[model samples]
Target: MIQGFVKTPEVQALLDRASGKTVEGGDDRLKAITRDLVESLMATIVKYDVTESEFWSSIKFFQDGAREFGLIVPGLGLEHFMDLYMDAKDKEAGQSGGTPRTIEGPLYVEGAPLVEGDVDLSDDPDETGTLYMTGQIKGPEGESPDGAILHVWHANSQGFYSHFDPTGAQTPFNNRRRIKIGSDGRYSFHSKMPNGYSVPPGGSTETLLKAIGRHGNRPAHVHFFVEAPGYRALTTQINFGDDPFAKDDFAFATREGLLPVPQRQGDSAYVAFDFELQRSASSDDEVFSARSRAAA
Candidate 1:
């Protein structure tokens, strides 16, 4: 085994310089985080006695897979870990009792047209498998929240999202909408049934999954961003309970309270669910996080 030198003073000086700890006039938080991250990575390299080829190959993998990083992060469970971390933090702060949050999965498009009460989200005349989903937005006390906005999006029957579909067959916001809840707090939408999807074949995500003996598949699910004046903005989604991958999502997004079964109603399927929002403890909690999202 190679002699471990990561904890030596020589390596410590190198890490400090590389992480900007030896420099001035940089963001303190960034410098501190960089220092910790570089230190940990250096320790890992020493522990594993990683070869130069292995280190360069890992860098090349990241460089080549830059575009698929969104999918990769979720597939690797990093995104789900964020939700779990936040949930634990909330519990530690004595806050609890609301719909569970899951991974957003990096497909959300901002600026969907806003509608009041209800709207139809599917417009393709050739589309089949109609789905009608209705839900209410309620406060933690089971009271209807006034002026709640529900932003919803999902994949089409072909397992392709609107803006992200490579076939160019879907119109802008084809299965996306922003609903302003009425006085009754009820929001509903009609759309084609969403189908589960796997990661792109022969792509970076699939390549990594193959190496790790995992499948890059997600279940049929609907994404939502619900917010009200006095309530914390919630980012959650529900997976169809009957889907084969629902219980084994590669994204680790499925949660106990988020599996909603669909009922057959005539030629269409119906899903009834409710979102319970926690009261916002701060103004920041009332708005969605400033994450980068596609706008169209």
Candidate 2:
């Protein structure tokens, strides 16, 4: 038995064991995906001749990335990939809707206070310009879906989100609320127009972006999840049209359909956008979502 250099042969052996794993009678799908990911990763390492030092450095980066996983996906365009996949799936299933879907970054809390028909997300003086968003909840059939629920949240003017920022745990529901759709499928909310958020400064996320010559700044936007009885739950965001970075978001979450068309009503900024949900074949298709899974 002879051990040569720690470069190629040794790395190949390590990768083979790491990526090649067989679990007798395990879930075939999970096993297959794991093998695929492992093999691809191993191939990349071999193909690029990644050194031990580089491999360890990457391990550290990934460790840090896990903490900021929510920011990582959007920064790396993985979120958009999923959106595209879902879009394709919907199309394959013969489902079409005019409203485009976007990423629901990993910051949504399981539950928020449900309001009657309208909600005021914040009243803090430090919060920026007032925003009044009104929209209708339409089903895949283009009819108003009565009693749909819209879960809405946004960052503060300073771009701090509850449950993810300092003192966020103290006021976990700040700038967050849920509104029940009316019989006519109308819903509204009053909140401060939240500015965009950025990846934590000088953190692992930032380091990764910097290495790739990228900045981690998402444009001003608000997150929403609409749920109806028989319609698919929609996770989306509405970007401020006037924001300079609206189209250049680091998360790449902004879409034209979801952009807020500002309508000045006195001192407030009002935007009207309709949410159309695809009709789900089964309740499981729509009822189970990030919101519900988080709750569970």
Candidate 3:
């Protein structure tokens, strides 16, 4: 009998059972991740002479990583898979027109200030840059989806989002809102154009990106989450016409149809856009989305 370490057949059997049960997600990807994780652990076990402290430390590290993984696939661009699937569905259903969809970032809170077709969101005296966003929410048949709601948000001119910036003032909990589309399916808003920004330099996401020598920079853009009864909620952004980061956004959220066409109009330049919605008979609940619910 071994003195400190257990060597009994019962202990060996328990270890085997535990190892076999580590992956239970039933999804193919989960199984693959489990296989890779176990292989990685086995390599470390062989390298460091397999001790309780080393094994537990590695387990804790992985547990933290898993805990921080928000369920939103858009956070990692897996939502691109969803985009492709939805595109196929649209074509199959003969749904045509409106705006193509894109990824919604995690910073959108909820319940942003509601206004008519336009609003001034800057609310800062020194806020530089002008943004006039004009668009329409229309059905696939090109009919106005009157009263459709547009929930919008964006980074400040400095690229700092509310709630996330400790040094900066916090806006309402959700930098989001419900806007009623006009009879012509048109909507618009006013805010300072946002600047590009990096992810916090050393968070888990940044650490991994820098390890691969990748730069973290999301382009200047306005985020929108549009919903109309019968239409699928569209989570997307409109890229600033001339932002250098538009093509090289770290999040890869910029889409071909999402770049707003800049138009000079007197004292202000306007970004014109038009969005098409999938039609159906559903309530606002089916269409409207808060931040938590959107990510969930």
Most TM-score-accurate candidate: 1
Count residue pairs with overlapping backbones in model 2.
0
- Reference-based lDDT, each prediction: 0.90, 0.77, 0.66
Off by over 4 Å in 2: 1-23, 167-170, 264-267, 290-296
Task: Say which candidate scores most in lDDT.
Answer: 1
Ranking by TM-score: 1, 2, 3
Better of 2 and 3 by lDDT: 2
lDDT of 3 by residue, 1-296 (tens): 23323335664455445455444545666555655565565555656577889778756755765633442234456666667787798789786566787766667666566677566666654346577877678877788775678887777767787766645674543234567776888887776666778776556666556766777777777788887766767777888657787888767677788876567564356787888777654564256444453321
TM-score of each: 0.97, 0.88, 0.71
lDDT of 1 by residue, 72-188 (tens): 999998999999999999999999999998888889999998987569887664356888998888998889988899999999988999999989899998889999898888888
How far residue 143's Cα lies from its native spot in candidate 1, in Å, is 1.5
Model 1 Cα displacement at 279 (Å)? Answer: 0.3
lDDT of 2 at 36: 70
Q: lDDT tens digits, residues 188-256, model 2?
A: 788876777788998878998999999998887888888888777788888988778888888889887
- The lowest-lDDT stretch of 10 consecutive residues in candidate 3 is 67-76
